[model samples]
Target: MSLDAADGTESADRLGWAWPDLPPGELGAPSPMFAVRHAEAPLAPLTLPSGDRIRAIARYEDIRTVMAHSATSRNLRYEGAPRVTKGLSIEDDPASMLNMDSPEHTRLRRILSGTFTPRQIEGWRPRVREIAGELVDTVAAASGPVDLVEAFAFPLPSLVICELMGVPAADQSRFRHWTELFLSTGDASAEDRVSAALDFAGYAAELIATHRERPGDDLIDVLVQARDDDDRLTEDELVALVFGLILAGHETTASQITRGALRLLSHPERWAALVDDPGLTPAVVEEILRYDGPGGYGMLRRMTERVELSGGVVEAGEAVFLLLPAGNMDPDVFPEPESFEVTRFDGTGDRAHGPHLSFGHGPHYCLGANLARMELQVAFETLATRLPSLHLAAPATTVPWIGEALIHRPVSVPVSV
Candidate 1:
């Protein structure tokens, strides 16, 4: 059944269908439906969890074309543009870089780029390691099976981002709830999402005010002092930026760590290999990202003008969903894409697999890629070393997944050391 038909009426397809489906028994594999769509309809129409119907671009080249094209925009406030969810318009949050286009996005991204540079992120390794170590230590000390998502995965990135922003650790739980609500898709009601956004913005405003007064040695303080050619971020922008960073910075990485551990534990051989050689942790992390990145698709983009693709022309104002997972699994890009081989991304030259779109490409590529990688690497290494005997508390197939979200993650990664 077509996506439109599935959306129009209650049907069996709706139950079995997911925009980016992981077929039964295929944990990290992309749905075979993607391969069919990629070949037969690169720009196939699909319905979002928000019930918004839009064209989905699943082929690697087509997805890249749309992402790299200057005419496509990330801003979703334009009239007639398709939206992921109601009450989640970028217009509602003007300070968010996610809502900006062109000069504005460039300006805001430039102001914040310095903080996430490779060098700066590398310098954060020790602290990230420290955080991961502490979390792993807690897991080790647990009396019984522990949900890694609650114990280690979620808190590691949460604590790191909280420290980076100088947010009190005590308030981490509150921020977690706010971010989950804000980023949720079908799981949350429109009123709930709006409430979460308002609460977060209010918190950010107060935090920014505090930073302005105290001016600590944190990213928040740096942002307060940041200027680009004498141009400074406005109060709204500052609050939005911090709110965006806090939400994006931790949530995605946290999901990755949780899923990565699950991937390793599911594949005992790979887990054993990593335990035998910690150096493979980076490669393992990369493979995990390629296989099961948190996001099902890249940010929604609106076509500013007609753009031709393998399937057909995408007219102006039409929403395009770049299915990142589909692109990452394209056979043309990665040989045997279904196989989760850690060494696939290891070698320097021809041995290395092509880059995956998990972090995205072009202008809006993930700003926190380096930091995310460091956290994932440390997470795997620490888990492999500190809890070499760690295993899933239940069968991998039985683990619950939060499928109704912009980013998919395990509800909880239950494990025992």
Candidate 2:
């Protein structure tokens, strides 16, 4: 459907553009508008939720080029750069890595790199499996329909992140609440956003101080030492880095766990296949990442210099949105992209499958990708092994979705075990 057609009766009165609708009955499928734009206007001008105009890059090659190019920066603080919304640009925050580019981004990322290495994340697998198993046991023992998101998806990652960051057990729920409010897209009021930001910053400062006085064997302590002993991180940067880690460490994985479970339950055969052969868990995890990863779009990139793309010439200082979901569904890359076959990435499919861009590409690829994979792998394995009879309590269509957010996820997944 055309943009106007998709907008339906609300076309004339809308304040900002609506995101392309997901294809009917195919959760996470690229909206028809995405395909149309890829063919017609690969770099189509679009209005942001902030009502700012940007060239939305829809094609896989164009999107990849923008992400991989050093000239296209994530730093929104540059004078006259375009923003996703009107408020405090995360770029303006001294503590936000989301807004940093180049040497600075590399510096902060280096500090945390050792913590999230594949070996480090792999070493945490036993702990992750134990956590997943306990949550699954709770669901298995429940008497009636339980919300999988509340019971399993949210807490497993929340606890794991808390452990990694050395957050006190009692403070986890508060951190989760702060994260939800802080990460709000257009839905949260400016006052709410400000309050969340202040609250989280204050809490992080206190936590960092405590770690300084009595360092623990956690990521936070490692950072605190880097700041105190090496003087590598400034006070503001330290606080911001820790805050960013807390927000990202759990929120994305929680969304994936909830969505992945819903995807499996929606396709009983797929769920059964995984239950029958647990060895397929890894392939299933990759397919889940490709089919319906939580990331709805790429982080905003502003062109530092004029660049040529298939769409057209983008002048310096213009912002571009890399539409990752659309690239994930590109038929040129994956055969029958809309269908969610668990084995599609296992070399048995008709077409050779390439890596999905859900975690992003290039220098700023997600730092938590390895940890996220481990959490998801354990989540599905535990579900299939312990609660083999689990099924959706409500129709998949009836599950409510959070609107106007960068990450697309169901509010809850009601299930019976």
Candidate 3:
């Protein structure tokens, strides 16, 4: 009953076997199959039950090489590829820069880079702090238990992006729903997910139209101009880009905030340290990105050409499923990789920042990294300082986690403020 790959490797431990049927309540554990395979054969031919052959890269350096290699590409939306979702065009149609190879990817990335400049992100500090202050104030008012995911984590990035993209308050709820639909790779029916994606695209089209009619000073307005002036992107490209921004921008931050908070809350000593020295907020955020990040395994990426990887050779048009969390926790690269260390990257005097594969590396490095960093710093500082008594209401293990999800979001993080 186990699937076989081109190399005739057969095992009951295919990556697909780990999902939609993962052992209930086993959240945040590395895929034992992947870990073992990587240890024995860092690159193994994995035969998915769907009859697709994928080269699974698991080691830290190898994974980073594959992600940053010119031969590999994020563009997986062509015909005949093994798709992550059946009805969603994200795997079938041409994607934005995130899913494109260079030249095209670079061109699109450049237009938006202006807004996300380091200086610009730094400028957003006070606003982000203000946002955090407001959310914490509201949580304090509730007095009763509150789910950090819904109350703070979700809204912080959602509203930040809303402000960035100029989305109005009245329309933000709808935006939130569309975002959840597009990003949901767990627990959503294919049909439901597809319908939501269509609705999401439809929503983008409306926003594009509105921006075209009455341009604002937000990123969308800038993108609309890029489409019209520089001819950098087409209308479809513009819509897809904006859609990608909203989808990728908010959910990832939400996961980090919720998961990162939970990690700190669970480790009281670390929590206390952060409270004492707020400067550790940035390093703590980096550690969170490395540890227990939301995006785990299951996202399918295609090989741009035939190449030898680790011990296995993959051909052009073939698909690969990389387990990033596995790579992040690789002992070969990170000493005591499993242990959460805020100062591991921050060396004394020199402060050598260790490479965290969290934001990814090379060309595909996360676009919103600066924004995510700022949010996390403000979030942790505010939460630790404001709600010193904040503690998890439910047992950490009792919280639901989607091991197979494209993004890991805690079902509920009830906390007392």
Top TM-score prediction, candidate number: 2
Instruction: List, residue by residue over 17-49, the lDDT tens digit for candidate 1.
Output: 234332322553455556666666678776666
What TM-score would candidate 3 get against the native? 0.88
Indicate whether candidate 1 or candidate 2 has the larger TM-score. Answer: 2
Q: Candidate 1 — which residues are off by over 4 angstroms?
A: 1-25, 90-92, 227-230, 347-353
The digit string of per-residue lDDT tens for model 3 on 47-132 reads 44234555667777767767777888777755667655445646555756667788888988888887877799999999989999
Which runs of model 3 end up more than 4 angstroms from their true locations?
1-29, 32-34, 45-53, 77-79, 186-188, 347-354
Our tally of clashes for model 3 stands at 0
- Give, for candidate 3, the lowest lDDT window spanning 10 residues: 1-10
Q: What are the TM-scores, per candidate, against the unseen true structure?
A: 0.91, 0.92, 0.88
| lDDT accuracy of residue 76 in candidate 1 | 70
The model with the greater TM-score, 2 or 3, is 2
After the best TM-score superposition of candidate 1, give how far the Cα of residue 168 lies from its true spot, in angstroms. Answer: 1.0
Ranking by lDDT: 2, 1, 3
